[model samples]
Target: MQIRKAFRYKLMPKGEHIRKMKQFCGYARFIFNRALAYQKAQYESDNTVKFSYTRLANLLPEWKHEFE
Candidate 1:
């Protein structure tokens, strides 16, 4: 007689919460960099890099409607 042990590994996030968290991160970065750009313009005098949604949408903007 022999006994076996099973092991499992997942390479990806699981469930809706994980998906939403990723999207929220995308959206949060969008909002942060956007706000940061304006702050930089007003304060930063160097050629430091900045970013925002002026490039692309990460999380869907429609999600905001959920809060409103």
Candidate 2:
């Protein structure tokens, strides 16, 4: 027999914390959308293209530089 346990906690962010949290969420959403769009474009351009995480990660620096 085995036993497993899980824990969950609720956040009660205030003022500045709330603002920072929202900012981080926005950045995460942006990165995800960009990655999805890249993958999609690659697929559309090349039917035999394979998904590569490394390729996406390698592009991050370029993206940051481009956007900044």
Give the top-scoring candidate (lDDT).
Answer: 2
Model 1, C-alpha of 30: deviation from truth (Å): 0.9
Reference-based TM-score, model 2: 0.84
Query: What is the overall TM-score of model 1 with all chains considered together?
Result: 0.40
Write the residue-wise lDDT of candidate 1 on 1-68 in tens digits: 99999999976767987999899998889677765665577456656655556533543455356444
Candidate 2 residue pairs in backbone clash: none
Model 2 agreement with the true structure over 1-68: per-residue lDDT tens digits: 99999999999999999999999999999999999999999999999999989999999999999998
Flag regions of model 2 displaced more than 4 Å.
Answer: 1-8
Against the unseen true structure, what C-alpha lDDT does each candidate score?
Answer: 0.66, 0.97
